[model samples]
Target: MSPGDEHDYRGKDQGGRPDDPYSTLGGTRQTRTRLPDGDAGLPHARRPVRNSRSLVTITGVVVLLIAAIAFANRGGGSDEDAAAPGAEKPGTTGSAPTAATGTKPVQGKNGTIASGFAHDEQGAQSAAANYAVALGSAEMFMKESRHQILDTVYSPAAANKLRAPQDLAYSAEFLARLGLDSDGNAPQGSTFISRTVPVGTKVLAFDDDTAKVAVWYTGLIGMSGQDSTKPVSTTWKTWTAQLSWLGGDWKVTEASEADGPAPVPGDVAASRSDAISKAVEEYGGFTYAR
Candidate 1:
């Protein structure tokens, strides 16, 4: 953690962070932990109780949505240092943006995803942030692209283990529920938007060859079409990745998610679907660096 960045460090199991609703790995986790009351500034910050129907479909899609780049949920461990190196006390009040750094984001790519990080603390953080973006991206909804992401950012064993279950989880029925096709595309004249904006990254722990990093993020999901039932909405989450230096890069071996440290929503009136669609099309993402 850098000087003056303390406000942004969401180190290990903070008191107001999620409890159980966010323990997903491989998109099968149905229970999501929202922020405890102490941090609920927004009217709808806390999620309502999960129903069987919700658990069956929405849960699967959410983790996939994170994978699809609608992105993350990672909780720090109970110990302050366990979740992030140089982390703040669990009871700390709010979050701030990560400070800018001199280091440039890694420019290499494995297919479309970024790759080839330096083997160090910043490298692990960069890996976690980038992987969170990929897993949480909208493309994770599509089969081939999803597979490619799994193989790219995760350890081979972890990717292999997660694939079958995730494929089952993101079923044809699941896509239909979110207004997406089997190919994970939006209907004609509609745009399915799922994007994760990584807010900051903190290294919880690290060594010569392994590290754990946490990524705080805000994401946008839902369809950008006037007729869409699920209109584009935003969410806040923390995703922690247990990573290792494997195959010459940082690869995720395990992951978990938790909700909020979210801010109060602004009073801005919602924009039209066409406007939202155009913005999404015009905006480009960045290569996140720690």
Candidate 2:
């Protein structure tokens, strides 16, 4: 699937399709006790003549050993001390770098979608993934919302080039094919669902002003309702975008997509349309970060 591919069921009408309606898814404790000697003749010997000095030395060594072991295991500091200012925390020498950068994900937004990402690799990946979500959302089915998203997510030149074709792709005929009205509304009593869940993102290339990122995602698109013919279904895809630092934000210059690194199907039973509708309504979406 490409960025603007019409194969996306969100914008595909279902009226004429005779094939399968919903297809193409991509402790232990120890104790010791001492016994007294029974000898009476050699009281000193039988009473176990205590070597006080040796006993004290042994006890001191044992205590020091325990303290040393504890300090080494704790990396020489408490958790609070490790977090204190000027403290040198443990290094991630052999460990994998986390997806998180511990920096604020986005500094601003264009409409509802995140924008103003930092001009770094992580920020570019974040921007691309978030842009994928916005472009694949149900909102993109409507003309007004689609325009808003294109303008917000794409660079000015790309937005201008994409507007007409994208508009055509989400036309009345296309919407009807997806069981949506001309205004991108589902029929009364039906819930239209189109959402993108980004599995992860990768930076293919990045520099100060340009970046290429790929977002692997799974998308849900279909209508859910008692009478709905198109049941909610899923598709896996990878959206790759070329982005440029423009207007103090990362914006899409172009985008393409591929099939997926889809996993095997699970054994879970499909939910009823009404249940799907209810879940979609009850659960809100998220603003994804890298």
Candidate 3:
């Protein structure tokens, strides 16, 4: 297969849903996963409850509390509850407006543009992949553009914490170390490649209002050229993002990276800078799958 067609990163099979996107990396998807709940390699099963009576009593109390809270919070028809000029119905704020309500295909949006992504698992994974690509790109190496991206990609709290450190990480000294100019621009003759080729995506959790997608991928980093210090090295990372399908597109509520969970390298031999440069130019990127 051509490099561009090497993988299906779109997270869908030919018919979609039941069948996942075919992985170019090959074989069945049996990689061990450590989820947020800390249960790794276990089939999705609830642990057996030990104490029946105590559990029932505790559950009844919790249910009663929840019911009481709901009753307390419930209100008579208030001004805010009444849908205003063009606002959505009450209790449905920030929900994806185009969620599949019938046989009708769902519409997607990015900002105000028509994106056409269904508000589903497939759509969330697609958004997460694209967002990760944007966040980890070479554009983040630039100041003004980096700020814009940071503000766009992260939640307000995360953006606040990320701004200073990110600025420091992509500073002139760091750029020089990575064989780039002061502005994070590579030498004219060399191509600066910073791309995350997603291996596969999994929705660790999904809901109507939010989704947490685990994007496991290998990325290419480093500058190209004879004297280039950080020669395009391969690394694997799992990027987890809490996504909200707001204002059309999935916006990252939070994001963080974890080391590896890398796969074994391919038997294909590593090429030199010239070959890599040529290959990069000749071979365009594709969506990856596991």
Best by TM-score: 2
* Cα RMSDs, all models: 26.0, 21.1, 24.1
- Which runs in model 1 stand beyond 4 Å of their true positions? 1-97
Give the whole-model CA lDDT for all candidates, comma-separated: 0.79, 0.76, 0.65
Tens digits of per-residue lDDT, candidate 2, 1-54, equal 112223322212533331222233210122223435654445443233333445
lDDT of candidate 3 over 136-247, digit per residue (tens): 7777888888887766666566778889988888879888888888898888888787877776677778888688988887888888788777788888999999988775
- Lowest summed lDDT over 10 consecutive residues: which window, candidate 2? 22-31
What lDDT is reached at residue 263 by model 2? 95
Rank list by TM-score? 2, 1, 3
Model 1, CA-based lDDT: 0.79
lDDT of 1 by residue, 1-290 (tens): 21232232221344333233443542335445567778788776645443444444654564455443411233232334343456553323232336433344575999878999878777788889889989989999999999999999899999999999999999999999999988899999999999999988887788879998989999999999978999999999999999999978899999999998799999999999999999989998988886
- TM-score against native, each model: 0.66, 0.68, 0.57
Segments in model 3 whose C-alpha atoms lie over 4 Å from true places:
1-116, 155-161, 287-290
Better of 2 and 3 by lDDT: 2
- Model 3 scores a C-alpha lDDT of 0.65
